[model samples]
Target: MKNKLEIKIILSLCFVTIITAVTAVPLQSAHAFSWPCIDRSDGKAPIAVSDDNVYVAWWGNTTGNYEVMFKASNDGGKTFGDKISLSNSTNGTSVEADVAAFGNNVYITYADNKTGDADAYIRTSNDNGKTFGPEFKLTNNSDSSLTSSSLPQGMKSYDNVKTSPYELKVAAEGDNVYVIATGGDKNDTTYQPDVFIRVSNDSGKTFGKDINLSESKGIVSERTEIGVLGDKVFVTWWDKGSDGTDTPLLRISDDRGQTFGDIIDLSANATDSNTTNTTSS
Candidate 1:
């Protein structure tokens, strides 16, 4: 009986060893477990998919400074390639990156503070995010030079609340790219930080003049999103009404952002509950 018990114990020990070996084998990482950034990071994490390809962009501190970084996956986001820095220059930090792709073209826009001002900048990748072209400054104006855009005056409220920060969001279709953002000082209620837009016809290689789309007096306006579908480009954002009441607004461009009409009010009863449109086609 003692010999039989020893044999049973040895068999149990062997079974335990076999289970441990099987479980300890390093398996392949999951699809979402990819794209490792080295430093402190901020990820709006705008991603675009083109059938089998996936492109992602963000602002990360991989090299001790915040720069716009991109990663691409050819196999449906199963695995990603190495990081591609898209700031176009290593001189200053960049943040608030927004990326969009159409066909083989990828466009990235961000607020670059390399010169102590957050100017809207853009870069293009003609090869599905593998490489980027030159940088184009959309707003061209310094932070202080930007004026607070107004909203339509009416039975509005003013809460004396501040405006939002300067951040860039962009969208693209074919060779056309549109960018929207806010800029300048927030403390000054007069000339409050305003929302602005810039359009590109040649795939973000060049941009048109910056247009202020707000219309309210003594109001602060900021935070914007741009979208393009067919020939129409749509923009939306929140604004502090003439009296600090919050208002949600929308506008559409029919001729590929050549001109915008109909600043539609999405919110009927306005308050401080800010609403923002943060995407585009």
Candidate 2:
């Protein structure tokens, strides 16, 4: 009886060892993991998908300075390539990166305090995010000429309440690319930021002048979103109204962002109302 008991114990131990060995084998495909960056720092990360390709953009102080970083996955999001810095120059602090992709083209837009005040800039990737070209300045609101260090710190909130950082959004389809951002008008003494759009006809190679979409006198808060479907372009954001309540607004472009129609209030009764739009061809 003692011999039989010993044999049973040995057999159980062997089975356990076999199961552990099989489970220890590494997976052939990489899984999604965290991107390392400096401590005590955070920023927005927006993603765009085109078929099986995935593109992601964010800002971090990994290089001891805040920079817009990008990562791409050709095989969906199962694995990602090495991170690339879109704001790879001495262009002050860059943050709030927004990404958009169509076919082989990828677009990234962010705000940089290179000229003292925050201005929107864009970088385009023609090879499906494997490489990026020089950044093009989209807004000229840095007339204040304040020093870079004295620029707005981190992200600005609306009415000192909502803490989400305002995002510079981008949308792309075929050879057309559109970007929307919230920035102050140099001529306005009230200093309230306005939503502006810039259109690119040559697949982000060149962009037209910045056209103000939200001409509201009230403060523009929260992130601005853009969507492109066929020849119609849609944009939405939140702004403070005369009643001291945040209301959602929308503007549509029927001619590929050449001109935008009057602002349409999405919600006038709701306070702190924010909106996002998604459309398909």
Candidate 3:
């Protein structure tokens, strides 16, 4: 009789413990919602933050054709203001935009086929993203509008259909702006389009001549990016040499792009598939 009573008391305690656990759990808070900053084919958004202001530059299809769009949030990205078209053109599509912010000025650079051929373009905003100045065309590829390379050793080269296709990447510090763009060459593998650069020392107000970064006789170089640190500037790209191998290479300039050091092969040992050289591995 005593054991039976003890079992009943233990079951009663277990029931109370279960009830307390269920009641102690707090209810979850309600989910919050935010309005769409941009609608209609808005993607590839690159954002830059300066102080409390956050700026976004993206390629959108709001215009009949694709164009570069800009917006800013003064309240630390909680809300964004109305959209602004940095390209603001009705011509050929402007794609692949990159943005940078310094002080009160915001700079956005993109590639568009405004004229007969695609070219690199830049626009600046002095008052954050509220307003933009005039557009500046950077590259003059009147001869060859494209950069092309023979297929790597094992791959076959094919003609790619492109209309004024130019890829652009940009980096800026203070009033100095650096842009790297590659035009494709679908014809002769021996003579392909080159990776060229344009620099603007006085912000985006003006630009210098297109400085060719690759060898004049080497196979085509493409997929380039630029970075600036202190007095040095760095540029890197992928290239195909006559040896039939594709290589990733790097070039550095200590005097702010006036000249570049030797091209260092980044993928020199890529043929060794077993070699673990990358940090991610």
Note the Cα lDDT for every prediction shown: 0.56, 0.59, 0.57
How well does candidate 3 match the true structure, expressed as C-alpha RMSD?
A: 23.1
Query: What lDDT tens digits, residue by residue, belong to model 3 across residues 136-189?
Result: 655443433233343444332221222232346667777777776664322334
Question: Over 4 Å off in model 3, which ranges?
Answer: 1-43, 141-165, 184-189, 216-218, 242-244, 269-281
Report the lDDT tens digits of candidate 1 across residue range 1-281: 22232332221111100000001222110000001111123347888887687999888766677778889998898999998888844666666678888888887776664653334566777887777877765532222211224312431222111111245677888788777665432223344445566677877655665555654335656557777798888888877776668877887878887777756778754664343343321
TM-scores of the models, in the given order?
A: 0.68, 0.69, 0.67
lDDT of 3: 0.57
lDDT of 1: 0.56
Clashes of each: 12, 0, 9
* Each prediction's RMSD to truth: 20.5, 19.6, 23.1
Q: In terms of TM-score, how similar is model 2 to the real structure?
A: 0.69
Predicted model with the maximum lDDT: 2
Per-residue alpha-carbon lDDT of model 2 for 1-281, expressed as tens digits?
22232332221111100000001222110010011111214466789999999999888776666888899999989999998988874656676678999998998877665554334567888888998988776543312322334333541321111111134678998899887655544344344556666677778766666566666554544357778898899888878766778877788878888777766678754685443342211
